[model samples]
Target: MTGDGWNAAVRRRLGLGRLLALGGPEDGVWITERAATSVLGAVAAALPGLAVTSLRLAPADPGAAAEPAVPPPPSALPPGPLRVSAEVVALGGRPLPELVAALREALFTAARERLGLVVSDVDVQVTALLDDLPDPPNGGPPPGPTDQPASATATAALTTPGVARLTAELGPPVQTAEGHVRVEVATAPPHHPLEVARAVRTAVGRAAPDADSVAVLITWAG
Candidate 1:
C-alpha cells in the first residue's frame, strides 16, 4: 500500500477513538474513548501498585440497546450503556483477584461519579505481576478547539454552568447544522460531565430555539 494510504488508515483508526454514551436519552452526551480511557489510566495511576496498561470503551450490546431519543450525529456513537475492557499490570502487593476487584471498582467509580459516563460494566484482565512499580501512565493530549468558524451560540455554550472550555478537532467547538447542535467541551470537576452537557443543551436551546437536538461531546474533565 502507498504510504499516504497507510497513513490515512492509521489516522482513521486513531482519530478520537469510539464515542461512548455519557448520559440518558435526554442528556445527548458522548465522550471519545481515547479521552475516557486516558482519564481511567490516571485513576489507575492513583491507586496503589495498579497500572491500567490499556483500556477501551464500547457499546454494551448494540442489538439489545434502545434507540436514542434524539438521533446522534453520524460521527458519534449511538447512546447506550457502555462496557469498559481493560488490561492491567500489578505490582506484587495484594491478592491478584482482590487487586483486580479494586481496579474494577476504581474504573466504575471514576467513570460514573467523576465523569458521568454511562459505564454499565468493567472487564479487567491482569496481564502481568511486577516486582516493582512501572512508570505511571501518561495522559493523551488534552482536548482543544478545532479550527472552524465559531458559531454565534459559542458564547451561550461557554456560559453554561460546569463548562470549562470548548475543544474539537474537525469543526468549531459549537456547531449547529440542520436544527442539531453539536457541542464539544472540556468540563470542570465537582459537576458531572452529564450535568454539564445537559446544561449546555439547555443554554444552546435558548440561544437557538429552532435547534431540535444537541449532542455534547466531553473532551476533558477534572
Candidate 2:
C-alpha cells in the first residue's frame, strides 16, 4: 500500500487509543486525534501564503502493524511522540524554504501547547504552487470594493482563541457570492461551537464590513 493508505489504516486501528492520556492519579483525561489534528492543521493553514490540503498522523514505528492490539489504560499509556505529515499548496513569490520552516514551527507549537503531543517531526509536501497574480484585465468588469482574498478571511477566523483549524476539504474558508462572504471553520474544545462561530463572524465583519452578509459555519467543534 502507498504511504497515505498505510497511514490511514494505522490511524483507524489506533482510533480513540490515539488520544493523549494525561498523567497523574486524577480521573484520566484524553485529547482526541481529531482535536489535535484540527489545532495543528489550523495553525499551519493560518500562515501567510500557505494552504493545507490534508493532514495525517503516522506511528513512529514504520513497521508497526496496520492493526494493533487493544490499547492500554490511560495510566499505562506513555507520552506519545507522533509524526505529522501535511499536503499543501502555497502561493508563489515568497521564499519557499522559509515559509515551510515557519509552518513546521507553528504546527509543532500548536500540537505541543494545545494538545500536549510531542511531535517528533513535521513533514510538509508542497503539492502545488498557487498563482499569486491577479486576474488579467478582462473586458467584463472591474474588481469590486467588496472583493477580498479568501486568505484574509481565513486569517480573521483563525484569530479566535478556540478555533483549532479550518477544514481543507472545502477549499478556502471564504466563499463570496453576490457580495456576501461565507466563512467555515472547525474549533477546539472548552469553547462552545456557537461561540466560536459568532467570534468568527465578528472578526470577518470587522475585516470586511463591505460584505453584505457574513456567514460562519462551524464544520467541526469538539
Off by over 4 Å in 1: 1-13, 145-151
**TM-score for each predicted model, relative to the true structure:** 0.87, 0.45
**Model 2, position 48: C-alpha lDDT score:** 85
Candidate 1 structure quality by residue, lDDT tens digits, 95-186: 88888888889999988887777778999988888898778766755655445345657878887888888876435677778778888888
User: What's the lDDT for all of these models?
Assistant: 0.77, 0.58
**Candidate 2: worst 10 consecutive residues by lDDT?**
136-145
lDDT of 2 by residue, 1-222 (tens): 899978876654354234442221121223445545666665675688877777776555545322212222222233345688888778887788998999888888776665555567889898888886223222222111222345667778777777776653223556666766766566677675545666776787788777766655444445
Q: Clash number for model 1?
A: 0
